[model samples]
Target: MRPKEFVYHRARDLDHALALLAEHGEEARPISGGQSLVPMMNLRLARPDHLVDVNDLGLDEIREEAGALHVGAMVRHERYLTDPLIRRHLPALLEAVHWIGHPTIRRNGTLGGSLCHADPTAELPAMAVLHGARIVLASTAGRREVAACDFFKGAYMTDVQPGEMLVSVIFPCPQGAHSGAFEELGERLGDFAMGSFGVVLEHEGGVIRRAATVCGGAKMTPIRLPEIEAALQGQTLAGLDAAALGDRVTGLIAPAGDFQVSAEYRRALIGELAGRALQRARDIALNAQP
Candidate 1:
């Protein structure tokens, strides 16, 4: 299916894109990568009166500053996966992204577009939450920052208001002795996972100081499990019990059932996945110890 009639405006820069949006108001959609929005448009799920293409806006770049990474809105999935900086500092992201759709999809999909699309089941959103990334949203009025915690509101919903575009995402590099991993259970390779989880751990002297667990495809939004993270802190990896860790995951999440899987089953899967993710993350952390 083809998208309905709409005015296509190729933006020469960020200002032009914002100008188009300010003029069109809520009827306008700023498109980058066109991986997510195009599909919705073609299916008539989205019917914007104006499509502001920001491909030429010069928003593509990856730079490291201070102690974190700044990823351009136009940076594609393949770039993030292949970039040396990303591979070295954000391996968990690459691990998770490899599970998204296919290579061609990743080649064209933009990081900002994925986050703004705000799919509850998407890998990038989970990554943002996992690393406590900050999202930069811009408009003619200027730019404002939103923490990943507040950026995602619900399924396919975000804090992105009309006339605002997600300009970039700021990911803080993992500090201290730490290790992380991303794991998911999918019916087939290149297919959306029934559920996915990203785990990170920081430890010193055999004691955990910090822990994070974020899960995708198991709720209305990519969710971070504070309950689980809290439980793991101050514990030794060798003494960690998988059963107890799994219980916290299942207890904290209330995933809704669908035609393919039941909420109860998803809860069970979350429990099991949490164990596997945490165990792997712990192993990686142990290996990093000098």
Candidate 2:
């Protein structure tokens, strides 16, 4: 199936894109990379009356401002694999990007597109939640920011209102040295994950100072594991029981099943992946110690 007939508008700038969206309202969709939207449109799952192209709007830079990294929404997935800032500051996100679709998809898929698509099993959204990232939205009225944890309302849903566009994402830089890891289980190398986990740990003198954990494919949106994080605080690396911590995740989430796997299977993946991710992150942090 093909998308319904639609008016195509090439936005010359940010204001032009906002105007097009404002005029068309919910009937318009702002497209950057179009990796996700195009497929949905082809399937007739999305039938926007207007296609506002934002490719030239220039939202594709990664910069640091006021202690946070400002990643333009149009930045392609492949960039994360090689970007020095991403590798140096967001290692977990870099690892997660490796699990995204194949080379062709990574070359064209935009960060903003993935977040807006809001697939519960995607890596970027889980990384965003784990890092406490901020999502920036712009429109004719003005610009506003939303927390990543709150930006995602559900699978394939977000807080982006009609006439608004996602401009960039603000990721707070890890302070005082930290190590992170991302783990997932998928049917195939490039397939959507059955379950995934991401963790960032800040430790000192063999003790955990801070921890952030987020799980994917276990909820409508990326679910942050505050319970596990709370348990990790002040825990010594040598004494930590990774398997026990993994078991705790099973009780915290209730994932829905699909044809590929049972709900119970997903729960098991979450528990197993959580432990592996947490232990790997801890090991990285400890190894970095002087």
Looking at model 1, which ten-residue stretch has the lowest summed lDDT?
A: 238-247
**lDDT computed for candidate 2:** 0.92
For candidate 1, write residues 1-290 as lDDT tens digits: 99999999999988889899988989999888788899999999999999998889878888999989999999998887778888777778978888877889988889889998887788899999999999999989999999998999998899999989899999998877777889888778876677888988888887899988898777888888898889899999778785678777888888988776889998899888888888888888777767
Kindly provide the TM-score of model 2 when superposed on the true structure, using C-alpha atoms: 0.98
lDDT of 1: 0.87
Pairs with backbone N, CA or C atoms under 3 Å apart (clashes), candidate 1: none
**By lDDT, who's the top model here?**
2
Instruction: Provide the overall lDDT of each model, using Cα atoms, as 2-decimal numbers.
Output: 0.87, 0.92
Error of 2 at 57 (Å): 1.1
Residue 30 lDDT in candidate 1: 86
Q: TM-scores across all candidates?
A: 0.96, 0.98
Number of clashes in model 2? Answer: 0
Model 1 spans > 4 angstroms off: none
Clashing residue pairs in candidate 2 are none
What residue runs in model 2 are displaced by over 4 Å at the alpha carbon? none
Q: Backbone clashes in each candidate structure, one number apiece?
A: 0, 0
